[model samples]
Target: MSQSKPEERLALELSCAICLQLYRDPVALPCGHNYCLGCIQNAASAEDPKSPKRCPECREEYGSLETLPKNFKLSSIVDGFLVATTGGGLRGGPTVPCDQCLDNPLAAVKFCTRCEMSLCPSHLKKHEERHRSLHVLVELPAERDGKRCPVHLKVTEYLCVQERLFLCSDCLMEGSHQHHEVQTFEVAKEEMKRVLEELGKSVSDKLQITEALVKSASEGPTDKAEDKLVARANILQNVQYVFSRFSTEITVSIAV
Candidate 1:
């Protein structure tokens, strides 16, 4: 086998294991590895509903889909690498013309994300004169955080519990969330954990009650409750198994 270059090796590491390709709309797991968002979600949902969501790469368990967060920084890097390496255009193909080169619209060398303009090599050099003023991105497209408050242009930082959606700080004070109940990420996580535990206990308790009721109905002077329970347990075994499995799933999901 041919040895891989350092750049190729790094690309491999960044690529999603599920897709076996460059990360697109990447999401980071608690395990610190990233994968395409759709890929991981599909994988988890494809698993038996009774089982914990396991990381395809590490076998790390997650309690719920809410645990994963998008890796925006890594996504930016992946998009840049893809466009640079694959000659990606505005349409995500080759041969997109540079917007600024009025005399000759050559194939773009870079895309200025802030200005939303493509640039040829000469214009790109001029753009670099104050590169810190704007970001240079690749021509390829990827999912980005568009949930920021349109007016403030900052990320929506709070979940408005009453509205059932996220809101940026500006929106909380001046927009629709002013009178709504809100919660931080930490608070929501704790609340979900409590709810999940309660759900598990409730199901387990109901199952035991059902088991007891079955025994009571069958009990007679000759019938020991213990003996009757043993005889009828197999009849309810499948139902019990389903409940037990569901309880485990609820508990594990909350922990994730």
Candidate 2:
């Protein structure tokens, strides 16, 4: 539980002040603080032009700023942390320590979405008994997103039929896929299942055809190849006998 504090603090720092989301294209300022480049730009733009541009967090002044330095290390670290939390969950080492277990220092198995607290096995059992309709996070919901749209950066709600991918509400409206057919994941599930069933039938038909082909091939003509080889060998033997007789006649005529 003591170690969990640092991880949470790091996550808080990595979040962009403007978007209130994880930093995208993180850039370091002169004030030794990091923010998203777009956030910094917007913040700078909102300020007075006569005075030097000041940082939103620290209020540090910068007279002339052409470019912001990329915080590659911080970005990489944040990305890694997000990856660990979002999908793969904790590995050998535990990040979320149990708040309930004080003396033992046990790792948290599940997180209560309502209480925003981690629980160990024993605590989780108690929590289940006490808290009715409790929602526990087995895995953090894909960075709190099922899957984000590539363009809009919002949670993808629908599957695009023509493109064959997930699309957000914004993407479905204004994007190139507006003309294309789409359906919500709820509806798409049944549609996809129907398509899958059709494909399965097609596959079954093809398999039957292939099986028939294989069976016919096995039964069709086993002796044809052997018969051809035997005929060729017999022709060669007859030709050889004729050649030997011809050679004997030539030898006898030459001797005379």
Candidate 3:
């Protein structure tokens, strides 16, 4: 049998790499490989901290972690294309094929600043082993308490109910939040809803008052018009009475 062309072989390989899989949030690595972001992170964390990560297939080095961009346009295109081609197997959802190659959608294993694409876990691990030491691996929500953490640089999720501020878990446990009531996200959401409702009512009342004032202002010209009509009618009546009396005097004088 004749051997498959290199391009065709590459396409086939790419298809196998992402077979039956759609990328969620896609990321890219510096080596131009893609992977699922979550899968990559877990893999990177699983290995011994001392050893470097290696590529799953070629054992090539891959770089550190990064966030994937939501490719909404590509997502829509892939979703439509899959629906048309797969008949019913690929359900319509928010996912897209890789823009560079159609064989697989970009996997969001980790983000790559250099490649600017989402990578699969395999690609992400390789990147971490190879380039993580040189470049920083930035996590999402990149700040906390106006300070940056060495690892994960993400803003901490802890919130203080008494202070009405977001804090790191460490800060919450510190002396600053001692004896203060701490609440979870659900409680905060409920309080926010209540405040929004009160604000909505106040806005509605103000709108109603504004509408009444506008109506009254619109009627001011009409009131002035009515007053002018009444005054003119009264003046006309007085003039008519004077004319009648003058005619009567003329008639009486002629008769005499």
| lDDT of candidates 1 onward, in order | 0.65, 0.62, 0.47
Q: Could you say which candidate leads in lDDT? A: 1
Give one digit per residue, the lDDT tens place, for model 3 in 159-190: 56666665545666566676787766567666
Q: List TM-scores for all candidates, in order.
A: 0.35, 0.42, 0.27
Least accurate 10 contiguous residues by lDDT in model 1 = 140-149
Tally clashes: model 2.
Answer: 0
Alpha-carbon lDDT of model 2 = 0.62
- The TM-score leader among the candidates is 2
User: C-alpha displacement of 160 in model 2, angstroms?
Assistant: 7.1
Specify the poorest-scoring 10-residue window by lDDT in model 3.
140-149
| lDDT at residue 72 of model 1 (Cα atoms) | 90
**What are the per-residue Cα lDDT tens digits for candidate 2 across 176-245?**
8889988898887776566556655655665565556545545656677666566556655655565565
In candidate 2, which residue pairs get closer than 3 Å at backbone N, Cα or C atoms, i.e. clash?
none
Model 1 Cα lDDT, one tens digit per residue, 45-127: 88898988888888998657776888999988866665664466333553545557443233455677888776654455456
Model 2 TM-score? 0.42
